[model samples]
Structure formats: structure tokens, C-alpha cells
Target: MAVYVQRQLDRQPERTYVIEGDADGYWKLAQSLIHGEPYSIYTPPRRVLRMPGFPFFLAGAMSVVGEDHFRVRLILALSGAVACFVVYLLGKELVNETIGLIAAALTAVSPVMAGFSVLFLSETLFAVTMLISLWVLVKLSKVQFRVEDQFQGRLWSVLAGISLAVAFYVRPSWLLMLPLVVFILILSAKEHRTAALTRGLLIIVGFTVMLVPWVYRNYQVTGHFVPTTLWAGPSLYDGLNPRATGDSDMTFFDQENVLNSMSEYEMNQHYTKRAVEYARQHPGHVFELMGAKLVRYWKPWPNATQFKSFWVMAAVSVLFIPVVFFAGYGAWVSRDQYLLLLITVGPIVYFSLIHLIFVSSLRYRLPAEYSLYILSAVGFYQMCFSSRQGKELNPE
Candidate 1:
């Protein structure tokens, strides 16, 4: 891992290793926060196009390092280590120590994750926060809802919700996960429906409490209660527009110039309406685009031009293909353990479904890949060493 970081640092002027592309906004936001300037990437008007969690993280690092790219990469590399540790914890909670070690090792060596860790992107941060939240939820599942244990379970549930809120501040794609979690608990806790419902409500309260400040800020700026960001409309149209190809292309934003006569909020609503109308008008074309997105989302290589190399493709395929196969096998063997399946296999499914309506890329899937690694570890351990006499995994 240190060697990979050094290699990336050595490629200073390369766009892949430098602070370019989407990293621009994150770096700009961090500078704004550091210098006590307005939090807008543009001039004068404040905008919520980018989430603040990663920018806040970058701001702290910049305060300490003062624009030193090498030091910033080292800080993010430490975050990558934390992510691997959290993945191990989640794997241990889901299965056993051996599986946890295997999952952590795989995560530590992941080419895609290692590459992203040194860049000024939020995938690594989001992965760490999401894994911690997942680990808390897995622990919560084990706490029986007895009268004396109700308080403990509720507390864990609230912590899980707060962890999820932190992830949301990094990436808004996780917004639907809160409700999905409640639905999963309801389905899994069949006998304790009442208790489960109470926990679910508490989870909502916890999530809302953590996000109130951001929501209030958005409401003050946009005159509406915007729970997420204003970029969703552009993102949605990137996948649903008439020229959509299941990949992101923001050229329309500049070409259309609708913002010339509209507020940011108004532009958002306008693009959203246009995208929905286009999807409705061309259902067949929309379905085809979805199929294209599914292929792109699951392809065993990077989609970005900068990372398109034979060596990179070969390495990613070597890692990604085996993980997918073993994860499927793991899901099959653990089908009876509903909570295990929900925690280990849920995020990829959720993200896959959501990205069918938005832009799709391997970058959008890295945050959930850690969960897939846990499942992959289980399958590898089961197939290689476990007895074949139907001695099933006992996660309890």
C-alpha cells in the first residue's frame, strides 16, 4: 500500500494522480472553508452541489499541511487503512475472525480502492463511514429485544443512524438507505414487530437530528426543505435525457445555459421535469439505456480514460471477477440467514438499482464493494476449508 501511494505521488503531473476532474470542487471547497471564504465553488451565490463531509475532511488536512499534496495523500491513505479495519470488524460481526482477516486483506489490496485513496475523491471516506454504520447495524441485529435489552438495542440503532447520516454528508446516494434499513428490520424481526418498529422510528429520529443543520441551511438558501443537494436533477438528466448513453456528460449544463434566466433551485426543478418527461416519452430507449448502465456498472474494468491500461484492466479483472463469483456463492449458502444477507449483500443491490436511473460508473460502486468483499471472504473460506458435511455457518 505504501509503495502504491509512492507511485501515485511520483506521477505528480498526471491527471490521474493530481487534483483534477471532480477533485477540483472538493479542493476548492476545502480552500473556501480554510480561508473563511463563502462555501460556494462559484462566485457570490452559495450552492449545495457538492456534499460537505469530504470537503470538511480536506479542510482539516489542508489546515495542517497547507496545500502539500503528498501530506494530503498520506492523510487519505490513513483513512483507507481505517476503512480496511472497519471492513474486518463488519466481517467478524457477520461471520468469524478468519473471514474478517480475509476481508480486510482483500480490501487493503484492492486496486480500485488503492487508486482512489490517493486522489481527492470521497469514495474512501464514504466507504469507511458506510462500513462503520453497517458494522453497528450488524451488532444491533444480535441484541435480542428482551425488556432489559431494548434500551441497548435502541442505542445501537441510533448510533447506526448517526453513522449513516455521516455517510450521507459525504455522498447523497445513501439517502434511501435509511428507509431500506427500516424495511429490512421489519422483515427480519417478524416476532418482534412492535419492538422493531420502535427501533426504526428511533433510527429516523437520529438520522434527522444529525441532518437538521444541513437541511436548514439548504432551506434558508433555496426557500425549500432540500434534504440532499441541487445536483440531483443534473445527475438524473445525465442518465434520462434524450442524448443519454448511460454515462455522465455535463456538457448540456454549459450548452443549454438555462441558468442564465433561473435560480439554482429553479434550474434543478426544470431539468428534473425534462428528464422525467423524456423518460416517459421514450420508454424503450430508457430501457436500453438502463441495460447499458448495468453493463457499465458491473464491468470488470475502470471506465475512465486515464485508468484505461492493459495492466490496470488485468489487475482489476483478477480481483473483481473472483469477488463477484464468491459473493454469489456466499449469498446462496447464507440465504437462510436473513440478517447476514441484508447486511453483506444489500448495499450493492441498493446502489445498482438506484444507478439505473442516474449515471453509472465503477466509482459509484466502490463504496459498496467492501460489503461484497465480506461475502467473498465467506465463500472462499467455506469452499476451501469448511467441512462438506452440512456444517453451516453459525453467525449467532
Candidate 2:
């Protein structure tokens, strides 16, 4: 196990540095953000938005070890170590120790997730923090929920919220899980409404407290009241940029395409305006885009695995649906039925919104991936140990 862990840890730095260079926004963004400078508009020059966690960690690493390859690689390897444990804890809640081990094993050697071991990407921090958040929720939801344990739950939930706050800090799109967490509160509060509501409120309160400072910082920088980061408008621009020149997968329904022949930013506004106008003008395309986006997000491509990074991600996303559905359905039939609904609804709604509008990238959805994996493991558990005669086996 030690050798395996070491090997996995050693493999990441070279690949991450190669794919996302050590210079440019990938490395410098961390330095800039940590020094309280302006966030890079295009760092790593691909999809890695200037998230909060990776740069901070890398900066800390730089302080200790200097900006050498050895330092960054070492930090990422340590990051992977924690991520592995988190996967185990998350998997343990859904199934047995064996499955927890399997899940961790999957995370440890996962060609996809293994990158966390080396690269200073948002996915690693997001994955680990998300695991902590979900594990806290699971631990708190037991029938033996005592006052002390409930207090502990409160503490953990607040901590989870902080972890999630860091997740959003790592990648703004992770805000999708916030709604899901809210759904858990709604479902959790059904039976113990007052207490659950109180806990839920406290959780949100904790999350809000953590988030406001960064938002205030963004507001100060951009002269706008932006609650999240500063990439959405530009990202929206990218989607429509190519569309105007017969390059996008989306087709224009009206003069909007013709008008979009302006600057990139101008074309973005045109597409945004037209999407709303066209939705009103042609509700069919809106619905079609919705359906089509869902398909685009899931449907396989030819020789997809060649883009190994995206290929594995698409498979993970597809598998996640089954995991969530089975676990969600099973939980609904149990005593803690509300948790089932909460677990399912918030994340789904959040994911649907992002998957629809934004460009579909694997890393974009990394935050919620842990939740689905946990839920899936639950589904796997229920499948392996079926009720001999309508009997449910609670792992507790």
C-alpha cells in the first residue's frame, strides 16, 4: 500500500506540469491570488479558473520549499494522500469497509483523480473538502442523534460548510452543491423540523460567514457586486464566440447569429440576449437546448478515451446517475426518506443549471462528483445485500 501510494503520488507532478504548465496562470495565478493581486483572467489558459484553495496551498509550499518542481510535486502528493482518506470515509458511510477500501483504491490509482496528487488544480481540494462535508452529513443523520452528538453535528456541519466555502473558493461553480445542502436541510427537518431547521440555519449561517469576505473582495476589485468569481461573463462569451462564425455546435434561430458577428464580448451579450429572446420567441429551442445539453453532457463520443482526462470524466458522470438514483430510491423507502430526497434534489438541480449553460468540462463539475460517488456506493451496497424479504440493512 505504501509503495502503491508513493508510486501514484510520484506520477502526477510531471503530467500536471506538462498539461497545465508550471508558468502562466497555472503557477502564477496562485502567487497573484495569495499576494492579494488581481485574479488572472486566463491562467493555465484552459479551464482552471482562479480558485481559492490550490493557489493558497501552492503558495504555502513555495514559502517552505521555493518554486522548484520538487516542492510543488511533494505538496500535491500530500494532497492526494488526504484525498484518498476522504474517499474512504465517504464510501464507508454508504457501504462496508470493503467498499470504502474499493472507493479509496479507485481514488488512489484513478488516472483521472491521481492528478490531484501532483497538480495544483482545484479538483483535489474540492474533492477532499466535499468528501468531508458529505461524511459529516451522514454521521449526523443517525437515529441515535444525541444532544452532544447533535452539537458535534452542528460543529461538523459548520465545518462542512466552511469546507464547501473553500470548495466554492476553489471553483465558483461548486455553488451548485449549496442548493443540494439546502435540500438536505429541508428533508432532514421534516421530522425534527425545529431542531433540523435550527441546524440547517446555522449551517447556512456558517457558510455565508465564510463566503462574504471573498465576495466583498471580488466586489472591490471589479467595481461590481459579484457574489461569485469573475469568469462567468467571459465564459459565456466563449460559447457564443465560435457559434457566430459557423463553429459552435449550436445553431442560430434568428438574426442573433448575424448580430453576433461583433467582438467576442459583444457576441456573448448577443447570444445571452438572444437565448432569452429566442426562448420566448421559440420555446422549442430552449427546451431542445435543455434536452440537447443533457444529451451532450452524457452521450459518448468516438474514440473518446483518447482524451483520457475528459473520457474518464464522462464515464464517471454517467455512472453517477445510476448511483444517485438507486441510493436515492432506496433511502426514500426507508425511515430516513427525506435524506434521500434532499441528497438527490439539491445536487441535481445545481448540476443541471451548470451543465446547461456552461461549456461541459470535466473539472467544472468536480465538486459534486464526490456526492454522486457516495450515493452510488450506497446504491451498490443495496444491490449487493438485498432484503431477503423486503428487509433493509442499515450499515450502522
Candidate 3:
């Protein structure tokens, strides 16, 4: 928190534009909400381009802080701290306090996590919500799927559902995680399929119920059942278009002047169709693009030019490289713990798969790094201290 505040303080005039790009949109939408104006950006007739979660949260902060970006950064820094503590709780639930503390410490010091924390982007907030959802799912994993234990199990499922819904609002891509989580829950209780199925349904019900209002609002504005935002089309096209380089560059929107000719909804549908058509017509190119995006998704260092400073690269690389190997080791040794592995490893896999189709970057992978830290802590403890303790952690 102190370091984040100090960094924000040191940036001077540019601090208002620190790590901007999407931050500008978020701040603008937030201001709209505060001043009771139309929610639109970039030559708007009130578009539903961005998700409401972060903007709404930011509006609350700006209201209290009177639109001071530094104060907003200070408030966001607290989300970073919450994420670290939640990672600790997740680690403790998965293993022991020692491993939990190690994971939390790693998250607290991670350059990528810290950098995104102070930014006005949704990653840090999403990370906190995602981690909390995973923690609830972990707790759900511990409960026996028996008729008598239905209350406890259902409660956790509902909490997990709510948390996951919150994450989805923050980042629409997370809606894809619902079916995967349901599959995991069902698979975990093979002998008690009825109970597991019931719990899964509860999760879906809880998740869907929470999203009803937002989805309805989207429907009202766009005349379509838009679950999250209309930005998906441009986001998808950003990765699959002919000029794509596996990086997000929406400048083509300006070159093509698509917005001037179409409504936001029409523009979203048009790009989505165009992107899909390009994928179908040029399968080979799509595969190559996917390959490039996969690399960008998993790269240890930032791909953005602004973050190319030698010290920045060194800090990211030094922290990430070791975590990669340690996390791999932890995953290997704990492969038998299917439930634990699902919650710890599932997110990175989910995000990686998503970014392989959408645009990819270190920023997209930040939310999943908390889970990586959990696994890395396991490896760190096993390699450095397990022998000293004279006992191995039982996967069961």
C-alpha cells in the first residue's frame, strides 16, 4: 500500500494518466456516474461498451474523494491489500498457515500485481473477487456432499456463486467459468450425483439471479440480452482481425470509422460476425494468431512498450521465472488433489484459453497470478522446508 501510494505520488503530472489506455475509459464512465451524465466514451450516444462494475465502484470512490485520482489510487490500493489477505486465506485453506503466508507475501510484492493494483483498471478488483470466489469453492470442496450436509454445502455454493457473479460483472470473460465450475462440482461427487447436481443447480441459480438486473439493463439499452457488455465484439476482433498481431490495438476502429456508420450494438454485432467469418475463412491464420496469443498470454514479462524499462523487465522476470518453476513443481506433487488443483490451476487455464482467442497480455493474466502464487508457495515449502518438517502434505 505504501509503495503503491509512493509510486502514484512520484509520477507527477503524468500521474493523472498513469498506465492509462483503458483507465481513461473507466475514469470517464465513473465521472459520468458521479455527475449523473450519460455513460458513454469516445464519441458517444450513450454506449454500453464497458462493464458497469468497476465504473460504479470508482464512482463511489470519486464521490467521496471528489474526483482526485490520487485518492482513487489510495482506495484501489486497499483492494490490492485485500487480494493479498484473501490469497493467504486461500493458501491456508489449501495447505497450512506457513504456505498461506508465503503466498500472501509473494502476491503483496509481485510487480505485475502491484502495478495493476494502482491502475484504474478492473484487474485488481477482479483479482480480489476471483480469489474470494475460489476460496469459497475451496471451502465447498471440503464439505461432504451428503443429504445431511446439504445446508453447509449449499451455503458455500451460494456464496461461491455470488462471488463468481461479482467477478463476472468486473470481467465478463468470467461468465465462461460457470459451466467449468459446475462440471468440477459434479465430477467431485460421483457417488452422490444427486447432491452434487443439486448444489450445481444452486450455484447456477444464485449466479443467474444476481446477474438479472444488469442483464436486464443491457437488454433495455441494446434490445438484446447482453450478459455483460457490448465490448466483446471489438475485443474478439482485436485478436482475430487481419491486421492483428496478437496484441490489442483498436485503432482500426478509427481507421475504419465503424462507429460513425453503426450504432454501438450494430457495431458490436458486425465486428463479432466479421471476426468469426475471418476465423472460418482463414483457419490457418486463426491458428497462427492463437499460437502467438498463447505465448503473449503466458509471457513472464510485460509486452507493452511503456513497461520495457530494464529495471521493470528485470523486476518482472526475476519474480515470475522462479514462480513458474516452483508452481510447476507444486502442481506435479499435488496432482492427486483434484479439488485443490481445480481451484488453484483452473483459473490460469481458463484465462489462458480465453486470451488465446481474445487479445493477450501480462495484464490479462494478473488475476490468475494469485492462484499461481498459491501453487508456488506449495512448491517453495516443499522444496525448502518439507524435509525439515519431516512430513509430506497429504493430498487427501
Local accuracy by lDDT, each model: 0.86, 0.57, 0.86
Candidate 3 residue pairs in clash (backbone atoms < 3 Å): none
Quote the lDDT for 319 in model 3: 94
TM-score of each: 0.94, 0.69, 0.95
lDDT of 3 by residue, 229-275 (tens): 88888889998988998998989877888878788889889999999
lDDT of each residue in 1-396, candidate 2, tens digit only: 224444654687554343343234557866765567665544222222355566777778777777765666777778778987876776666555655765566556555466445655566776676667667766666534466567776776677677677667766777767666666666746667766766677778778999888777655654555566434544443333434221123333233444334433344345566445544665554455556556554443312233447665565545445655665654554436445334434454566577666555444444455455544455555666655446554555
As for TM-score, the candidate ahead, 2 or 3, is 3
Show model 2 residue runs off by greater than 4 Å.
Answer: 1-23, 33-49, 69-71, 143-150, 237-288, 299-353, 365-367, 375-393
- After best superposition, candidate 3 residue 356: deviation in angstroms? 0.9
Candidate 3 residue spans exceeding 4 A from truth: 1-15
| TM-score of candidate 1 against the unseen true structure | 0.94
- Model 3, clash count? 0
